[model samples]
Target: MKGRLFAPRLVLLHLVFLAAVVASGWLGWWQWERAHEAGGSFQNLGYALQWPLFGGFALFLWYQVVRMVNGTELHRQGESITVPSATGHSESAGEDATERTTGGARRRSPVPPPAPPVTEEEDPELAEYNRYLAELNAAARSR
Candidate 1:
């Protein structure tokens, strides 16, 4: 863990984070000074307060990165985190794609699968239109 923290890439990251925090603090201080000056406005005071929050957020992100690198995040504690699939069912539930059970009620997709393609003989006009579009696309691509 200590070795990982001091790795070359991590060292660079640490320096960057330190620079961000320092820069934010310096900006906040500058804004605070501006707010007290004769020409200062409420906007300067707002910025003075906002800069510290940015520094605090940077600190939070840095700490989270360190924790993730150390494999100490909550998700790494052998706890299963089930994400819902696009069909609105927990992926880990092992339910069939055609149907799924949610809250003791079976649910299926309201939208049906698309119908098979229509052959040229079945719809000659549509097929001709499609061929025309394809020709136009090919012409555009050649240019």
Candidate 2:
């Protein structure tokens, strides 16, 4: 525990946590002073109360980080989580489309393939545009 706490990265984190707490406390103090001034409003007082809570929250987050680094954080067990696949099948099912292996990698999503390109014969507007372009080309060649 002590070793983890004194690690270089953790030491940096501890300094950051201290800075955050001290800054928050200083901000709270500034807000409190502003709240007591002649031009002060209730908003300043609200902020004065809120800044200390922010400092406390920072302390809580720092503690959680330390706990996580130390691997002492509690984790829930005996819970089976079911993830849904792109093909509308849950992982709990016997067959998952996402789990279908292709050279050890998962298969792609089951989206339909793109439609083939439309031919001018299949589209009257496209055929009309092509006829107009042909006429313009022939006129240009004559000129």
- Provide the overall lDDT of each model, using Cα atoms, as 2-decimal numbers: 0.77, 0.74
Query: What tens digits encode model 1's per-residue C-alpha lDDT throughout 22-123?
Result: 999999999999999999999999999999999999999999989887764333333334657655777742243234345443344466554455679989
Can you give the TM-score per candidate against the true fold? Answer: 0.51, 0.49
lDDT of 2 by residue, 29-116 (tens): 9999999999999999999999999999999999889778655312121123366755577764223323444445344347634444
The backbone clash count of each candidate, in order, is 0, 0
The residue-level lDDT of candidate 1 at 52 comes to: 95
Q: Which clashing pairs does model 1 show?
A: none
Cα displacement (Å) at residue 78, model 1: 12
**Ten residues in sequence with the least summed lDDT for candidate 1:** 72-81
Query: Candidate 2: lDDT over CA atoms?
Result: 0.74
Which structure among the candidates has the greatest TM-score?
1
Question: TM-score of the candidate numbered 2?
Answer: 0.49
